[model samples]
Target: MKLAYFYRNLNQGGIQKMIVNAANYFVEQGNDVSVVLMIPGGEYVSLLDPRIKLIYFRSLKKSRLFFSFSDILKREKFDVLFTATPSLNTFTVIGRLMARVKTKIVISERNNTVVFFKNSALTLSKLTFLSIPLLYRFADAIVAVSKGLGQSLQKVALIPANKIHVIYNPAWSPELEKQAGLPVQHEWLNDDTVPVLITVGRLVDAKNHALLIDAIALLSKKREVRLIIIGEGPLREKLQSQINSLNLQDCISLEGFKLNPVSWMSKANLFVLSSDYEGFGNVLVEALAAGLTIVSTDCDYGPAEILEDRYGFLVPIGQVNALSEQINYALDHPIDRDLLISRAREFSVNQIMQHYQSLFSTLIS
Candidate 1:
């Protein structure tokens, strides 16, 4: 099978990581795989399997990129074209139609698009939301990362219920286990005396890291705790000010992005996710793989489904007191690490990719 995956870039993002994992896995299975990008070069570019082909366009403009994408489809005539997110998927669908190609298009929804753009003031967000129902129905298959997310997309976009499929992200791989064992140099993690809480995500508005900072400040009064926030984004300065205002500089560390956050997760005492919403929380699975205890906001779609109330603790979103209380409770009452590890295995790349392979086979046949 010749599989072509499309995305904006191979940047440090959950969706990008998942695409790279799928491409790598499919290539290893003796299928021809290619990753097509609108922008060239990203953090994950180095991580791509050498056996897989990578094609990128120089045009930053979406209109120009759409034409280039159509050219590729007309030339390559891939067996399956798999892409994700709203805007990029829209581009792929329109481009395929323009090319008049027979490529089977599969677009995966990685977030709650309705919730994602609901409060946004950007014209682009409005356009993307409008484009969802209009363009997405044209695809061969539509994948939502969680059941809750799938239902939401169907409701807002009025996509046929039969057209949408719920597929969990390939959040775990054997390579992650190897990376988890690697040594981390963080002082707080090294110190067994003080408990370390780690959260990995872009410092964006949706992540609600401000809530995490407040929760840590409250936790600090009761006990000794340190938080390391991995990943960098536009909200760094704002987050830093919040930390300073609360005098949580000592307790909270904005560690920025790391290539291998699994190593840090493996060493941390507890993992936290304070997002306002998610399509699926990939870090929760990565934390489980590291055998770390978790306390995540009971956000729509992902965390509840992943933790299932048994593997970890979930608190209502944006409640500083509730989040703090739960964090304290989770630290005091530790769940079985092996149980978490067992749950993480369900999301292993090999297992999830088999489902994808089945979908592709059915589409192309």
Candidate 2:
């Protein structure tokens, strides 16, 4: 089978990592795989498999992106292709129609479509939301990263229920485990004597990182602990301000994006997710895979599904008080690391690749 995957870039993001991993896995299975990028050059570009073909559509002008992808697909003639992101899905749908590409197009939804629209600042997202029901219905299949996310997209985007499929994100691999064992030269994480709480994601508004900072302050009142945020974004200055105002400058470290966060995860006492919404929380799975205890907000879509049945603790989103309490509880009572890791294996590369293999096999046949 010839498979093509599309995304905006290979930026330091979970979705990009997942695409790279899946592409690598499929190619190893003897399928012809090509990864298409709208714009090239990102932290994760080096992570792509050497066996898989990579194509980049450089944009001298942003308006031409739609036709650029269409032109590529028309020529490649893949058996099936996958795309995620709302605006790009809209583009992919129209591109397939205009290009008359024979490939079965599968578009994945990566956020709570309704909650995402509620927090959206982009006009592109609004336009894409309007096109979801209309354009997405034309795709071979629509994948949501979680069950709640799928239902939300179906109801809010007016996409037919039958058209939506739930596919949880896969966790890390042996390569990640080896990376986890590598040395991390951080002063705060140097010693396990102090409680260390770690969180990984872009420093964005939707991530509700400000709430994490506030929760850290609330947690500090009870005991001594350090906070490590392992991603960078537009809100860094604002988050730094929040940390300074609380005089948490000493305890909280805004460690900007790292190519391999598995090292930090290896040493942390606990992992956290403070997002207001997520299609699925990939970092939580990474933490679990590392055998780290976790306390995450039971946000709109993902965390609860991941933490259910005592696997981990889930607090209400944006509630500093609740988040504070959950963190303290996790610190006080440690979960069985082996069991936590056991749960994470359910979403391992082998398990998830089989899911995609089935989906693609059905679609191409």
Candidate 3:
């Protein structure tokens, strides 16, 4: 099978990572796999599988229509075109019209299509909401990262429920765990006695990191806890203001975008996700794989389903009081690390690869 995966960028994002993983897995299984990055001249090209061919449509941009992609697809002769993200779907739709290849286009929606629109401006949000139903009809199959996300597509986007399939993101399990010892260079975190609460994700509005800061402010009054937020984004200034206003400068530390978060995950005592909503909490799965006790907002789709039955605690979304209480509870009552690690195996790379392979085979057959 000649499989071509398309995504908006090759940057360090959940959807991009999933595409890379699926493409590499298929390549290893003796399939001709290639990844087509819609965004031209983007960094992180080296992060892709060296065995799998990579192509960048330099003319493609997020705001513009993907006119050049059709030519690329025609030349590549892909049997199957698997595209992730909404913008790329537009190109896939266009490619289907222009290309001669018998391409079965599969579109993957990585975020909640409806909830995402609500965060935008009034005019733009209305336009996006209206376009989703029309855009979804273009794909042969639509993949949602969670069942809730699929339901949203059917209910809000008005796509048929049968058109969507829920596929959860795979967790990272590094071969040979990095040593648990703290680096001597991290002078602020030299004391190994303090409980470290880490949150890893892009510092954006949907992530609702401000709620985490507020919860930390409350948690700090009673316990000697340290908060480490890993990732950088446009919201840094606003978040910094909130931290300063709450006088949480000492309690919270912003570790901007570490190349290897798995290393930090290994050293952290707890992992936290304070998002308003999530398609599938990828970081939560990573935290579980790292054997960290977890506490997450009972967000729309992913967290409750993933952290169900004592694997972790799930508080109501955006409830600062409840979030603080849960954090305090988790700090006091230690979870069985072995149990957390065991549960995480369900989303291992091998298991997820098999699931994806079966799905692709079914789709193509």
Candidate 4:
């Protein structure tokens, strides 16, 4: 099988990581795999399995990139073209048509489309929202990371229910446990006296890191707790200011992005997610793999499904008080380590890859 993944860049985001994992998995399974990028490079570009080919359209301009992408499809005509995110998915659909390729197009929706359009301020977002109904019908299959997101896509885009398949992300890789075992020499993680709470995501508006900071402040008021936010983004300075303003500089630290956040998760006492929304909370599964107790916002599409109330606790989104209170409660009563580890196995990379292979095979057959 010749499989190719299309994305803007191979950044460290959850979607990008899933693509890298899938590409690696398929290539190892003896399939020829290629990663097609519109933008030339990203941090995750180095993480690709050496066996997988890296193809770049290499243009900052959308029109040039689109034409370049179509040309590749016309020339290569891969067995399957798997694309993530709305922008790239749209391009793959229209580009395949223009190129007159017989490639089976599989588009993965990694966010709640309704929430995405509602929160987005960009004009391009509006255009993409409009294009979904017009473009996505051409794709061979549509994969939503969560059932909530699958339903949301149906409502928002008017996509046929039968066209959508709910496939969870490949979150638990063998490397996750291996990385978790690696030495992490952070003061907060090293100190057993103070409880350390960790969260991982880009410091973007949807992540609502500010709300997490406020919750940490509230959690600190009652007892000693420390928070390590482990991703970098645009809101870093603003979040730092918020930390300084609330005198939480000592308790909260924005440790930027670490390639192996599992190392930190393995040592942390608790894992917290304060996202306004998510396609699926990958970090939560990583935490579960690390045997850490979790407190996540019951945001659209992912957390509730992942945690399922039985695995971990979920609070309403953006409710600082509720988030803080739940964090405190979760700390008091942690879930069983063995149970959490057991649950994490369901999302192992090998298992998720089988579902993807099944979809691709069905399309080709």
Q: Please, what is the whole-model Cα lDDT of each candidate in the order they appear?
A: 0.91, 0.87, 0.78, 0.90
lDDT of each residue in 53-103, candidate 2, tens digit only: 989884537688767887898889999999997888888889899998788
Candidate 4, superposed: residue stretches over 4 Å from native: none
Tens-digit lDDT track of model 3 for 7-81: 777776677667766776788889999888766533456656688887877574554444567677778888788
All candidates: TM-score: 0.98, 0.97, 0.92, 0.98
Per-residue accuracy of model 1 over 1-365 as CA lDDT, tens digit each: 99999988898999999998999999999998999988889999999999999887756675687778887888888999999888888878888999999999999888878777887899988898898888988999999999999889888778889888888999998788899999988788879999999999999998999999999888898999999999999999999999999988888999998999999999988999999999898899999999999999999879999999699999999899999999999998888989989999999999998889989999989
Model 4: clashing residue pairs? none
Instruction: Report the alpha-carbon TM-score of model 1 versus the true structure.
Output: 0.98
Q: Tell me, by lDDT, which candidate is best.
A: 1
Instruction: Answer with 1 or 2, whichever has the higher lDDT.
Output: 1
Alpha carbon lDDT of residue 244, candidate 2?
91
Residue pairs with backbone atoms closer than 3 Å in model 2 (clashes) = none
lDDT of 1: 0.91
lDDT of 4 by residue, 207-323 (tens): 999999998888898999999999989999999999999999899999998888999999999999999999998998999999999999999979999889689998999899999
When summed lDDT is taken over every stretch of 10 residues in candidate 4, the lowest stretch is 57-66
Can you tell me which runs of candidate 3 are displaced by over 4 Å?
40-44, 61-65, 122-125, 174-185, 188-190
